[model samples]
Target chain A: MKHTVTLILLMLFFAVPAGVLVLISLASGWRFPDVWPAGFSFSGIALFLQQKEQILSSLASSFVFSLLTVGVTFFMCLVPAAVFARNDFRGKTVLEGLLLTPALVPPMTFAMGLHFFFIKLSLADTLPGVVLILAIFSYPYMFRALVAGFQTMGEHYRICARNLGAGPFSILWQVELPLLMPAVVAGGSVVFLVAFSEYFLVFLIGGGRVASFTGLLMPLLSSSNRSLAALLTLIFLLLPVGLFFILDLSLMRSFRKKGMA
Target chain B: MSWTNNRAGRLVSGLAPLLLPYLVLFCGGIMLTICQSFGVFTPLPHAGAALDAYAKILTDPAFFSSFGFSLGVAMVSAFCTMAAGTFLAYQVWQLPAKLATAALIYKIPLILPHISVAFVVLVFWSPSGIVASIAHSLGIIQTMQDFPNILYSGWGLGMVLAYTLKGTPFAMLLVLALLVRFDVRQIQTAAMLGASGVRIFFSIVLPRMAPAMHTSFIILFLYGFGAFDIPFVLGESRPGMLSIHVYNLYFKHDLARRPEAMAILTMMFFFAVIFIIAYSKTVQRLENGVRKL
Candidate 1:
């Protein structure tokens, strides 16, 4: 009885929403008093294919900026993450907390201010500007993940590398980077998801100049085209899930090959 | 002294990469917002006093209504998310190993973007939506139009539903992280005692979950309060979310009212900061007092 209750609850919460989305995406003129969609049609999928070029370009743009944000955040957080992990300076807690505030506070609060600054610097409405803003907003996740990564890694590797006459640069490249891959992936996934899904920040900074998947989808979402909106949302769900699945598989394979799993 | 100085320099240089952008972007942006709120960095020259924007915002009854409405929606949604998440997590945790693994389905919503979740809510709950359709077919409602206009009923219930939908999994993730380490033996022992199930949950389990509950509450509550995406899709315009308010003032209105937008953002930033401080302090005090009890 208990198990049955749990299963029912799980299905209600998890399966129902997804099932509704799938049904809506395929339904033609699905309307009131129809317990199910009126009839299945290829209209949504047809529309997606018809506008494939524009849709694909926006997807690619979102992908590129999100990946660039990940790269920028990785670089920004690497040394600082190491410093934070290894040291216990005065006011360290306060400083770390302060740095992590971006993650906690609403981006809308500071984004307007940054928009003004970006406009002054000619960074607004540029791809680099979008990447920079996203990186700035999201680097804290990478910072925290890397700090944990470095702590788990410990100082022993660096010390051993120095004993072997390796310089700091070589040690970081050859030794620390491989072990930190998991942390990077973890952090990068979050940063990617955030950047990919963000609508307002890109809209504000890009000034309609930037092509983003979210930008393309936001207007359509509110339109009368329910089928198309549902189709695009499904695609939005699929891309990240597919990427993470592949990532997880490859990480597992690599770990197994290295006898680390 | 030289050794310490060198160490200090190394630390500073090491942190510079992260600190540079943070200072220039995050701190600088906030400083600019505060300055703009005071009529210092307006697009056009401002002749008014520094506090004029603040005075304007404080005087406008719309601002207070929006603020109160945002607070209410956030609080209600966050509470619902926490309650549902905690209950579901406990259930999932108690399941047998295989069934528990199946319950991992709850994390699906966590992967979904906020906008997508809002879309999901729209697809499911709008007047002509799935639930209403089902109800109409089942004779529960005479017509689809007879379905309650729950989405735009002006109480922000639609936004609450959306937030709770998106947030419950997040709350579950946090709670389950702590729950995985919790020994089942404690529960068995408590059950062996004369304690009722409710008593056991409140006494033994609830305390263990309290820290995670508090943390997730702060995060979820603040997110619901300040987030734009969910509110954008589901929010009513009159006395809309504060984020929407800021967006309208900044973008929709003229450049002259930029300070007013900045003022709202400035107030939100301060409110978030104070909320965090006060919340942590209150939690700390309550926890200490509980320990004494």
Candidate 2:
């Protein structure tokens, strides 16, 4: 009985808003004093379809930028995480904390300064600039995840590989990379989400020249087009969730194939 | 050079590639913000004193109100999110393995964007929104306008609702992570000894869950305090969130007022630093006390 109640409550908590979103997306003439939408239509979906080129472009750009951010962040975090994980040094905790401050503090605090600097370097309004900034701001999540991954992994594997006359690159490529897959996926998921969902940072750096789905969606969310906003919001939710699902499936497959699961 | 010194040098050099990007981007970005806040590095030269922007912002009542309002919204939302999340998590944790697996749905909101959560709140809670429509049909509200204006009520209820919606799943994730490692035999043993559910919870379970709760509270609080997406979607004009204020000061105003925006950002960063120190210290103290118990 208790389990049933918990299920019901959880369903209500999630499904109610979800149902409302679907209804709002379909409602053509929803108004007050009506419990149900007076009429339903595909106008919102049709409108989205009509703007397919623009929406698809924005989606593709967001995807490419986020993918690039994940790749750059993974590369950047690799040596640092190895250094931190394999060795302890003076002021390590403080340094780690300082490195993590970007995640804690509002990005707006530093974005303005970065904006001016990017413009000075002529990096503003460019795709690589957007990717670089996103990578910088979002790398901490990857850093922390990788550090935890390394800590759990311990130094034994590296030492054993070295003892076997394996080069550092070979050990890293062959042994450590496979072992670190879980951490990479975990970190990459968060980095992707952060970069993908980010709005203000992308808007500030991209300067409207580098289009993002968020840039396309945020203004419409505030507009009076409730149906369209709801439709686009669904799309926004779809992208990251869909990406994570695919990542999860592929990672699971690889782990199973490698007998690591 | 000594062998140890040479090894250390090599390590430092190895780390330089990673640290260089961070130092240049993160640290450099903050340094530039500070400089501009002091009117040092700006697009246009400033003839006024370095502290003029600070003085102007410090004297403004709007700044204080926005700060207080942000604090209130963040605190309330974080508290509520944690409360609901803790209860739900405890309940879910008590379920059988089959039911627990089904309960993975709790994480749905965690995958949604803050902006999407904001829209969900707006769609459900606005005056003419779904809840209001239901209320009208049920004769609880006479008309659409008669529905309480929760979104634009100036108390930031809209932002709070959105934050809670976004944060609850996060709190659940953190708490559940800890709970999964917890052994359930202690609760069973206590129950067998005639300990009441509430007593077992407070004496045994709550202590175990405290660390997760505290960590989630801090993370969720800081996030709610500083996040821009939800507030941008749900916030009102008057007494806006600090993020909105910074946006206006930077984008809406002319280049001359850039210092003021940077000043707000600098103060915000300072506040975040102070908050981290205080919160972590307090959590440490609490943990130590619990350990002594």
Candidate 3:
């Protein structure tokens, strides 16, 4: 009984805020507290659809940047993670720790200088530059996930595969890559989310040229224009929700199939 | 032998395309930032040899105040995130698996942007917001007219709590992720031995959760300290947070003060680095002590 009650309380806790977000998203004119939206309409939906070009562009930028972030981070994490995994190399611990240092710096500082660095490099306010910065921020997640994943599988499979005259390429492509896909996806998903929602680097570095969902959505934050922010919030919420939902469903299905066997 | 060798070579070579772009994009920013922190921000990104930027940023009273405010909010909100997250995690653990699904749903807050989170919080709580709206309807006061802006007031902690709320879902999600792999039988055995719920928790649950909790605390705090979004929209200008200071330093307030802005950001670097180090050590010690227990 206590367990059930506690569960209900947790439900109520999340439900209230979630309820508010949904209510505000659907309701027109922002009146509150009669236990539901006073006058619900699809007008917010209509309005957002009306602004679909701007919204679609922002959404496109978010996806493209995130895709690049994932690809870049996954590859970037490889050399260091492989080094740490494949050897008892000197300074491995120090180097591995240092690789994660980007997470420890203030983003504002990074953004301030990165914007400048881009100008010097002739990549300022460019799509590629923003993509690079976003990837930098997400490197730690992909690196950690990849490193941890690599460490888990013992060297036994590789040894056997090698004895069978399989080269390093075959072993990795056929054996390692297949197993690493889940971690790659997990790490990639995290990187994608980080890049997708990034507000600072895009705003400060892109100098308003970028139209990331977060960047476009940030301007309306405390004004009557907030309905726009709220709309984007639903979109932002959807990205993660959809990814995790699909991932979770597939994982559960796989597990259930395995169990039935 | 030829086939095997070719595949091995293929894997290593195929990696170059992915690795090269990442090195330039991701690692490049990190390298650039560290160097710029030392340079005088002659033209924002162009670092001059003189270290005058760091000097001025360290010396300025206004810069120092913002740094202090950011640190204070980060630490306070991190503590709140930990406390609230832990309590909620405990409740979630006690529930059945299906109910835990509802608990997991609480984490939707983790995905919302800081701006949107702050906006909702503003309406629901600000004097002219939802709370004040209700306050007016109840005849608590004449109009919702004069309600103080929660954004900048003695209710300073309100912003901190909102930030904490912004993060608690994340902290809880990370903690719950760790907890799912935990061995529950030991705790049950302790309960069987007549251990009080609190005692069993302090002895068993927390000790096991130490690493994840510490990590959650540090990451959440680092974000809180370095956060540009929440505090920008929610905090008052009277006590600027470091992230905000770093921002307007380079962009808004004075275009000439780039060096000072860079210096203040360097100071933020110290806070972010130091707290994370302290957090890792704390987690290590807790893990060791738990092993001993």
Best by DockQ: 1
| Worst lDDT 10-window in candidate 1 chain A | A92-101
What would the per-residue lDDT of candidate 3 be over residues B96-154, giving only the tens digit for each residue? 87766666777766777677677767757766566666666676655555665566673
Angstrom error of the Cα, residue B193, model 3: value is 3.0
TM-score of 3: 0.87
Model 1's CAPRI class?
medium
Off by over 4 Å in 2: B1-5, B279-293
Segments in model 1 whose C-alpha atoms lie over 4 Å from true places: B1-5, B278-293
Question: Order of all candidates by lDDT, from best down to worst?
Answer: 1, 2, 3
- When only the first chain is scored, the TM-scores of the models are 0.96, 0.95, 0.89
| Models sorted by DockQ, best on top | 1, 2, 3
Q: Which lDDT value does model 2 have at B52?
A: 96
Q: How close is candidate 1 to the true structure, as a TM-score?
A: 0.95
| Cα RMSD to the true fold for all candidates | 2.6, 2.3, 4.4
Question: What TM-score do all the candidates reach, one by one?
Answer: 0.95, 0.95, 0.87
lDDT tens per residue, model 2, A62-134:
9999999999999999888988888878877667777777787888877788899999999999999999899
Q: Which of 1 and 2 is ahead in DockQ?
A: 1
User: Alpha-carbon error at A131 in model 2, in Å?
Assistant: 1.5
After TM-score superposition, the amount by which residue B236's alpha carbon in candidate 3 deviates from its true location, in angstroms, is 1.3
TM-score of 2: 0.95
